[model samples]
Each structure stands twice: as structure tokens, then as C-alpha cells.
Target: MDRPELPLAQLHAFLVLAEELHFGHAAERLGIAQPPLSQQIRRLEDKVGHALFARTPGRVDLTPAGRELLPAARRALAELADGLAAARAAGSGRTGRLRLGFAASLAFTVLPGLLHAHRERFPDVRLEIREMTTAPQLAALRERRIDAGLLREPPPDEPELKFMTVLSERFVAVLPAGHPLARHRTVEVAALADAPFVMLPRASGPGLHDRIVELCREAGFVPQVAQHAVEWQTVCALVEAGLGVSLAPAGIRRIRLKGVAFRAIEPGARTRVAVAWRADDTSPLVAGLLATMSEAGPTAAPPAARPAPR
Candidate 1:
């Protein structure tokens, strides 16, 4: 005693014939013969267990059941059409969710412009942004906890990740506004050789932390660490507190702590910010974002050199 399935073709025929009220006209619109159209309507009527149309020699009209089914049939077809369109849009990367991770400092540099451009081009794509340091960003990318990451100095040897540098900036010295060196427009790396340094722990951003240490060593002395902070803002805050001096990417100058000053460094070293994703990721959402980044180009404006604090 199972009920029969209602075929879409029969439902479609029913709606068309219901509107035309004539098998000849409905069949013409459907590009089929009148006999087949009649057969489809009869099958649909059988499924609904009622007569859908009343016919005289020259007239056709809907029964009460047919009238009731009209609105529901129209709504069903409309909903199906909408669902198909949404699926196609998601497949083409025009509408979907992207979970993105970024270094906190990038909010001052490449991230804002990149995100704006992506949103402009794909307004329906939802972006979920997470602030993370380089190390954790990499780990998250590998764990698939994120779709992509904007990080500083991604390791070149990570075989499972793909990276593209989006920004490169020279190292700058961060010092207390009241420190004598802050008066100089440019400070040599060697000037801070014996000075205690406020630094990010190597664990937070190994590539950048190690590079700063190497730059100091090249200048003939290892930086003596006095304090550590996990974020650039905190490092700048510590420097402003006169805890110790530190070197950071020029982009860090954007933090603008009233008590902190940024100065160009000599024997210049540069750090890079890159976008990274799993090597195996083939999701169209990731591809779309990567394409947008490529179109935008790696033209993030470098931090303007700041005048000495008076």
C-alpha cells in the first residue's frame, strides 16, 4: 500500500497545463505533442488521487484540488531553482566561507588592503579572520584549522605548505621616546650592541626573532634580552616603558605608542610577510582568494619613515 512518487516532469506538465487550461497550448509551450501532455497531466492527477482538470469539447478548467496545488507547486519549483543557483555560486567560489589567519602586525601593513579588495570582488564570500603569530599560524594551516594564513617569514622548507610573499620591509629600531638614540633619524645596529633588548620570544615568531638575533650578531654582539612580549604592540609598549630596545619590521611603526619611537636601522635586514595554505588544498575558495591577491599585486606601501621624536 505504498504511495507512488510524483515525477518532476509530471508536476511541470501539470503547472503548464493548469496555466494554459488547454492541452494544445501547453504542449506547444512545452515543445511536445498534445497527446503526451495529456498523458503527463493524467499521470499527475493519478498521483494526487483526484481529477485535476474538467474538459468540455472546447473548454478546460481546473478542479478545486488543482487550484490548491498551484501555489505549492510554484513554490517547490522556485525553491529548487534557488538551491541550484546557490550551489553553483559556491562551486565557482563566488559565495562561500573562508577562514583566514593572519599575524597581528599585518593589520598595519598588507592585510587591510588585501581583505578590502577581496571583499569588493566577492561580496558574498564570508571571511573569518583570526589573529595569530607566525608559529601558530603555520601549525593551524597544517592542521586545517584555517583555510589560509598571512604570516611573517614562513619557513622555506615546509614541503606541505605553499607560500607567496606579499610584503617585504626593512628592519627598524624601536626605542623609548626619551632614549638618546630616538633623536637620530637612523640608528646603526651596532649602537644597541650592549643595550638590553625587549623582544618577542623565538617560540612566538622564530623566523623574525632569529633574524633579529643574527642581525645583532653580524654587528658584533648578541642582543642581551631584558624582557619578552608575544605581540608587536606589546613589544612596542615595553620599549615605551623603557624596558629595553628592540628591532622590528618597519610596519611595526604603525603602532604609534606616544612613548615609543621608530628609527631606520643600518646594515639593513628585511623580513617578509607571506600568504600560506596547505599544498593539497584545491578548494575554489582558496583559489579565488589567491587569484585576487595575484591581481592586486605585491604593492603594499612600505611604512613611511618617521621623523625623530622631539
Candidate 2:
């Protein structure tokens, strides 16, 4: 079966008249003269083979056909709006869903700003995120599950993924308030050379964990990694138990922990955080987030680690 052909100009005319309910008023709203508005509406009614509006000197009512076309007309205009919006967003580099993967720790920092800016500019877009270790983030990026990742510097000689070094987050010694280091305003990694440590899982972010160890090694001592864990909350919990101290990024302050004491490390030592994307996926979403981060600030500065609310 064939469907009736609908013209955009006709549809526009009908919609404007429908809204105004008066030929003169509709023309005024459309910024046109009354005669043309009337001619267009009449043409639409003739083509549709139905009188779309019932009229009298002082009364206006939508005929059954007009009533039915109203919803369709509204939908047509809405879709046109969405299409135009998608185009504008893409041109300004803010459209599309961004599948972002990040190391659990990176999410505590600048990534939030990237996401916030993306939302402010393209509220209609879908933003999906996943938290994983650098290894998984890299793998997911390769597999196309994520458009970009927040990760650390790549080891020497692998140039497949496009990456940019954004910031080198400083290492902060996180301790329980009662611990010895808590009393010091600033402590060096050398000071904790022989101290027990709660390490980020080697599988999750080995670069960061190893970098902390290397800092101690530079001080000529080895760190005693007493516990291995993937999440920051666990490290803080272990610290609260008086088990060991952990080195976390400046953003770690967002976690509110009763027993945790986070202090800046001496020598300005820190882990590098970078943004990476598949060299080919140039989706507007990925580009937009990075662009947003370039201009925006951090999302929410957490007070301290109190477990994520239930």
C-alpha cells in the first residue's frame, strides 16, 4: 500500500495556523502576510483531502483531521530540532555518547570536569563510563568498548594508541590520624622506605604502585607492601586498621575517612595521568571530553573518604 505524500511547507503552514487559531494571527506569528498564510493552509487542506480547521467569524475548532495531524506535526518538528541540534553539537564538538574508561583513581581527578562540561554542552548525549585498571582500560579501548581512557604514561616503544600527558598527579601519603606520619606536615618517600604499605593491585595500576616503590628505592630502601588491593577505600580501611600507609593522588582528599591523613609528599613526586583514545575512533564524544577538560576544572572535591553512600 502507498501512503499519502506530505510536504514540509504544508505541514509548517498547518502547524502555525493550528497554534494561532486565526489566519491573521498565524501570519503575524510566521512573520508573513495573512493572504499567503491562508493560501498555504488552503493548499494543505486541498492536498490532504480534508478540512483541517472549522472556522466562523469568532470561533475556531480543529476538525478530526486537524486534531490527528497536530501530534504528528509536533513530532516532526521535534525530530527536526534534534537533527539540527546533533549537527550543531558535532560542529562545536560536543555531541554523541562518550564511552569513557578510567583507572579507578583517575575518576577522582580531572575526569569529572571533562564529564561535567560534556553534559553542560550536550545534555541530549549519552555518557557512559567504566572504572578499570589501566590494563583493562587499554584492552577495552582496543576492543572498542570505550572511546577513551584516563591512564598513566605508556612504557617505552608502543605507539598504537594516541595519548596525551595531561597531568602528573602528586603522591600524597595517606595515613590514619593516629599514625606517626600524621604528625608531620610533610614527609618524604624515603621516610617510609621501611614502613609497611597497602599497595594498589599490581594488576590494576602497577605503574603507580611501582612508581611509589621506585621513589623509596631511589632513597635506597625497599617498601614492604603488606596488602594488595584494587580499590582506594580498601587501602584507606587498611590504613585505619593501623596496618600500613598508602600513597594516593591529591584527588584522594575527596574520600572522607575518619582515620585517614593525607599529606603532600616531599620532592613533588607523582604519577602521570594521560588521556588516550584509539587512533581511529575520532568520535565527537571523545574529542569533546578532552576539549572540555582542557577548559574546565575538577567536578566535585570530595570532603574525604566516607564509603560511597549506599
Candidate 3:
């Protein structure tokens, strides 16, 4: 047998008539004429295959079938309303998970502040944070593996991606606490021309590596890289171990490594950290995060805040 689908208009009319018990009053409540209301009730009874109301000359009352269906109809309407609300929330980015990729170096500096601010504004959003290097972060974004990336390297004319710089910091010299040059408040880049350098590998962050080399070359000599580490923190650790001195963003000085000292570099070398995502990504959750970043402005924490070593 074919099941009869309940029409909302007829169901609503039936419900109002059942509550009023008077055809004229129910018609008034429904903003329809009494004759039309009566006709709608009759059509509803035929579709339901049940006489749902007992009509008297002056009044009406629910039949057993109508009494039985009242609660079910109410529950169905409630569920429909709830479903619509959920759909709207999802569309507005009020709830969902955002996959975010960030450079490992930002873990101590920019990442925490950005996360905290975002969480405060959008508590229902789940931030799935990943620590990755520049190359992999860009690859993940291109593959749609991550919704957005916070990285030190800016894309080179990739038309499919859009980005903006979130923070810029002067490059400073990181050296062992006892290094002779550490005695000065600021070190000239030319002063370290012959010094051994502990650097992050090119594969880990090619843009940053190349930028440092370029800065050194501009200072009159190529840096002598004595060791390579996978992370900025590791590079700083090596400097603390007296392996060699290196150049790093000023914001990195916020990390409190006992044996390392950070000094301003003269004729400053600078680096910018940027956030990027696919130009075609139009998901509300991604848009929400982008809006939050835009509102939060540049997120460079003062170097005085000591972050735990990575």
C-alpha cells in the first residue's frame, strides 16, 4: 500500500481546529474564512483516511485518530526546526573543525596567540593544528590536506593561492652567551662574516635559509655553515651548545635558553611570517578563521615573554 504523506498546511489547519473546537474561531486564528477552513479539514480527513473531528452545529471535538496524531505531529515539527538550525549553524561557520598548518618555529611565538584569540572568539570551532615546514605546508595546502598555512616562506607567484603577511621581525644574531661579540648590544652583520654558523637545513625552510645566506653575502662574505638542524629551536640549541652562531628572527629571542644570547643585527635582515590558503577555498570555516586573523591584526608577541623550549 502507498503511504500518505502528511502535508504541513493541512496538518497545521487540523491542529488549530482541534485546539479551538469552533470552526469560526479556528478560521480566524488561521487567517482564512470559515468555509475554506472547513473544506481544508475535509480534504485532510480524506488524505489521512480517518475522520479526525466530530462536527456539531455549534462546536467541534477531536476524534480518536486526531487525538492520537497530535503529539506525533508536534514532535515532527520540532525535529524539523532543529534540523534547520543545525544547517544554518554549519553554513555560518559557528561550528566545525578547521585544519591549520603552521611552521614549527611559530609554536612558541605567533601560534599560541593566534590560537588563543581564535578560540576566544569561536569556542565551538575545533582547531586541528599541525606543525610542518614551509615546503610541506605549501604542498598540503595545494593538495587540500590543510585548509590554511602559517609559514615563513611566501609563495612565489602561485596564482591558485592567496596570502598576507601576519608578522615581520628583524633578523638578529643568535650566539652562545660567552661569545666575544655577545658583549656588544648589537652586532654588525659584517662582524660575523668569518664565524661558523649553525643553520636550519634548506629543505626544512629554503626561503629562510636562502634569505640568511643572501644577507650574509650582502655583508661581504658567505657564511660558513658548520651544522644544520631541522628547526629554528634546534638551531638555537646548537648555538647555545657553542656549535656556532646563527641569524634568526628577533621574535625567537622570546625563548629562554640559558646559554644563548640574541643581539640586534646592524643593517637589519628581516623576515615575514604569512598565512595562506587556496584562492578557491570558499568554506565558511576557513573564511571564519581568515576573518579572525584579519581582525586580530599582526600577531608579533614581545620578545620578553619567555616561551618554553620546543
Candidate 2 local lDDT, 1-310, one digit each (tens): 6777778777887898898898888888888998888788888888778999999997677999999989998899889889998798876656566788877766677776666767897786687888887878888888888888887644444466887776666678888788776777677777887679898877776677678778778877888889987788788889888899888777777778888888777765756787888877657777677676666432333332222212
Candidate 3 on 1-310: residue-level lDDT in tens?
Answer: 9988888788888878888899989999999999988888889899888899987788788899989988877777778889998789889988889999999878866888889988998898889999899888889999999999998858587798899888876788898989988887778999998789999888877888889999998999999999998887888899999899999877778678989988887886668799999999989998888888898787654542233233
TM-score of 1: 0.92
Taking the tens digit of each residue's C-alpha lDDT, what string does model 1 give over 1-310?
A: 8977778888888889888988899999999999999888888988899998998898899999999988888888888889999999999999999999999988988888899999998999999999999999999999999999998888878999999888877789998888989899889999998789999999988888888999999999999999999998999998888889999988888897899888888877788888999999999999999999888766644753577755
Q: Give the number of the best model, judged by lDDT.
A: 1
What are the runs in model 1 whose C-alpha is more than 4 Å off?
1-3
- Model 1's alpha-carbon lDDT is 0.89
Which candidate, 1 or 2, would have the higher lDDT against the true structure? 1
Write the number of the candidate with greater TM-score, choosing between 2 and 3.
Answer: 3
- For candidate 3, the 10 contiguous residues with the lowest summed lDDT are 301-310
Native-to-model Cα distance after best TM-score fit, residue 142 in candidate 1, in Å: 1.9
The per-prediction CA RMSD against the true structure, in angstroms, equals 2.0, 6.7, 3.5
Candidate number with the higher lDDT (2 or 3): 3
- Candidate 3 has which clashing residue pairs, if any? none
Please give each candidate's TM-score.
Answer: 0.92, 0.68, 0.88
